[model samples]
Target: MSASVTSTPVDHAPRVPAAPDTAITAVADMARRARVAGRVLGHAGAEQRNAALCHAATALRDARAELLAANARDVAAFSGAASFRDRLILDEARIEAMARGLEDVAKLPDPLGRVLAEWTRPNGLKIRRVATPVGVIGMIYESRPNVGADAAALCIKSGNAVILRGGSDSINSARVIHAAMQAGLRAAGLPVDAVQIPPDTDRRHVADMLAASGLIDLLIPRGGKSLVERVCREARVPVLSHAEGLCHTYVHAAADLEMARRIVLNAKMRRTGICGATETLLIDNAIAPVLLPGLVEDLATEGCTFRADARARAIVPDLPPATEQDFATEWLDAVMSIAVVDGVDDALAHIVRYGSSHTEAIITEDEAVATRFLNETDSAVVMWNASTQFCDGGEFGFGAEIGIATGRFHARGPVGLEQLTTFRYEVFGNGQVRP
Candidate 1:
């Protein structure tokens, strides 16, 4: 996706007030505003919401220079791994992608007011289940600045008001992005308070959001495991958890060696910092010697390191030994853990033991084997002959995702427009009395 818009240096900073006396008070105030805005937005027509999304996309493109400048400040201030820096930095292409994402979301069918199901009772009562907005949402995410754009776009299209609280690492970028979103809302004659961010990136603010049970209808924490775990543990509100992405790519015994090599390399090395990137390589022991060496060389060429089990070390002696903890870890970098399994069953067993249930892929040409892998592997997304890196909201064609949920309830995989809504029953009754 791309946007072809030129930008000039200008300050389009939004008109936001200072923080309140306490984080709790600030969250309360923001939530109140969002709740009020949400009621108006929910009743808005789909055309109006789509217009807002388009305007926001244009606003983002118009503010490209300012957005990049803010991101540069964020990138400079960040003190983390190279992979994390990659997640934080935004260039011309990424900015264009963000703009395009919003436009794409605008083009999607509106999620609200759809009759999911309808039925009539014997008493002549008609009832229909209709989709509706999830109301005010609290979005807490980390360094990826594009997350703010994606979340806002999805929320606006789904007719929900959102309050974004990005991590300090990317707060500058988030603020500018938030400004662009507000500009879009204002242009469409929607309430600007419909989308907001906290006054500052303080740790206490997270607590404030987490404790806002009645105000924030739903809380989504999209970041590292610690962040998700903390929110799940303490948040008084309902949470749609985006857990650690300890994804896997398994090379089946019936796999094509060449295809397996390509899939494994892309799954692990294509932006290794992303949650969808494969962190573990499970290969069948029958073809470990023929396929493992080539796969290792391919990833190693791309600066990937490995922690190998003893069985794998026998195939390649120089590889570092892997421990139980290493297999269970989510290494969001150019590092992977390898293990040789007996076959598909052993692979599935290993996954059941250590996997995060986010995404798992099997490389095999045999239809039966692929079917079993796809059916039996317990994950939000299961792939055959594909890269685990394909586990993205944009890749899934939901415009853009707020996050890939690892949990089973509410939503799984990419949390997109439809997933952001709840349902209500609308009934049409006759004037007949109860018999």
Candidate 2:
């Protein structure tokens, strides 16, 4: 699904400084240079920007050996949970995806200077809403060094400067990739500072970035629950984020058993470590007896644990009881939670209470049920008879995404080049003054 955000509210607050420590000072310096870089990049022209992106894609391909060596160091140094290491590790295909993402962005239509809205006043004045860059954006993420490349490429192509801060585990890999992006910018005769990565990944630098209100026009956090929570809570800059993805897939009574099974399996198990992975499965009570048991047995054999509510347990007899906390948790792993709802209405109520508003899916053959589920659900992306895993930018043909924003205000769903730009009103008049 495409996002509908064409503009955002301007942050009118003044910048305030924290204690003058060396770490924060360095981060602030980077923000200032990014602002300057944004100005230069805004005028770099679409041709120059596309050339830069092409150069970056080639650079990544040429530097494949060096990139892998750095990533190996990152993989060895990771000390977090086993699931987290999955995000840190990079392979040849992942690097290829990164490069292709840059090339894909270059192929997208220029987001800037496009007229989004236009009108004429009775006083012979013509006004048009034109897209403009959002200025300097700070992309803070934990793990997933590929995000560093994607973020930089999107911001650069959309006429905005960017400051990247990857998790410490992938800092070395991030540096190598960030340098390649800078080389591309310089080769295109654009400012190298257009895409800057902090020299250090200290926690203090992240704090500094949160308070960099004036320097950073927008804050996009791409990481786990903790990282996203910290940014949303303390960030002084305007933020576009969702704290976590407690995504769900509801299997309705009218759903075809085969379609329901395939959709649910892929939704939860295709890549459980991602934000789009479905964590909770709600089966319509009328159909639970006919369908839930076999689905559980097959997934159990495939290494997925099922935590179910009392009603579901009564039918299946083997699922571990799901806790209240489990219903609200975003388990970015192979564990799945199951529940039985009375009908489509009950299913929607359960989702409202426990869902993250990130992504939700309904498997149903009834047109009325599918339409209601899609219309009534308050999520960034909603699906019908499709896996929630499809809520991705590359899948939407945007090369790659900055993040899947669940915030309804500035940006929502898959954040791509279009979501990254805001608009300004351009008025044409023959020396007309306000009456």
Candidate 3:
């Protein structure tokens, strides 16, 4: 079954303790309030929802100083992996981008109440598939407090209520950001409960949220393997898995060296911590000798460490040898794996072997080769002559993303406004009965 859906969330809530009993009641109550708010938001017209989004955008922009200040505290107090620390920090540009994301979501066409499809039966019965909200969604994420803003805004725009559980490291920033977003909802006459974060930075509360099966219609996990694995394992509600974006970029024989060099750099280094960053680099044996040196040198110059397979190691003699484990890993940092393949078939086979079905890109000028790679690679997002990083909701014109789904069913790639909706069949009959 598909998992996208939500309603309004609660706001200005105080932080509570992480005790299991307290967490059970508090998270359950949060779900209860969100359910009530979701009903109201579900039927709210486009104008009202759009106004709420605009207010949210304004609120985010106005709260920039406060957000940056809060983020500073969060960053200073953080003592985790540098990759995660990077995700936690929110500078001026990032905050502004969050605000613009809200504005962008506000400008998109309303996803609700639209007819997706229609058909007429022989009995003169007309039926149409119309989009509707999924009711209440539980978003359990770690690090990256901006996810709070993005998730909250997208849930509001899609007519779903979201219950956010940001990482404990980002608890303070989450609380502040959640409050500012709620202020916008309140200002726009929307229910504050329509978008709620945990009252406390409690891990127990996350368990409570996971166990709240019937109350939460869907659960989306956005984080590292451990976090996503825990949610998928414990959540009683349907969980949408983004998985590790073990993304890759294949430098094919037909690839233009210049284009391949640029795309590889951007795909890997543009934002190493993001899920869309290519974790593995595959070069065709036909082009390995010619392309590997320049490309390897370019990335190395930018402080990227390379782990290469035997075939690729021949081309870059000084590169550290990659293990089987390296090809399967999602470095989520500046580290990446490289393998040399024979041709399109070889590259495709390797991707199928190691890909997380997240995103994959092929840098080539030949339409036939690009088409083969795109068709053969079983990733949610397959790119041709472009960076895998483009596999984002905003780039796809969805304002911001809740997360990118790697699952094959329901939704894949970027989960945005349209992906956050469900559908029902509405039938119009002229006093007709089934034969």
* Candidate with maximal lDDT: 1
RMSD of each: 3.8, 6.3, 5.1
- Model 2 per-residue lDDT tens digits across residues 88-107: 88899999989888999999
What lDDT tens digits, residue by residue, belong to model 1 across residues 1-435?
Answer: 322222221222233444465543788888887888888788999998898888889888888898899899999889998888999999999999998999999999989999999999888889999999999999999989999999999999999999999999998899888888887877777887789898887788899999998889999999988999999999999999867999999999899999998899999998899999999999999999999999999999999999999999999999999999999999999999999999999999999999999999999989999999999998999999999998988788888999888787899998899999999998889885786
Model 3's lDDT to the true fold?
0.87
Candidate rank order under TM-score = 1, 3, 2
TM-score of each: 0.94, 0.94, 0.94
Report the poorest 10 consecutive residues by lDDT, candidate 2: 1-10
Candidate closer to the true structure by lDDT (higher is better), 1 or 2: 1
Runs of candidate 3 exceeding 4 Å displacement:
1-24
Give per-candidate clash totals.
Answer: 0, 0, 15
For this target, which candidate reaches the highest TM-score against the unseen true structure? Answer: 1
lDDT of 3 by residue, 162-261 (tens): 9998988888778777877777777777788888877777678888888998889999999998888888888888988876889999998999999999
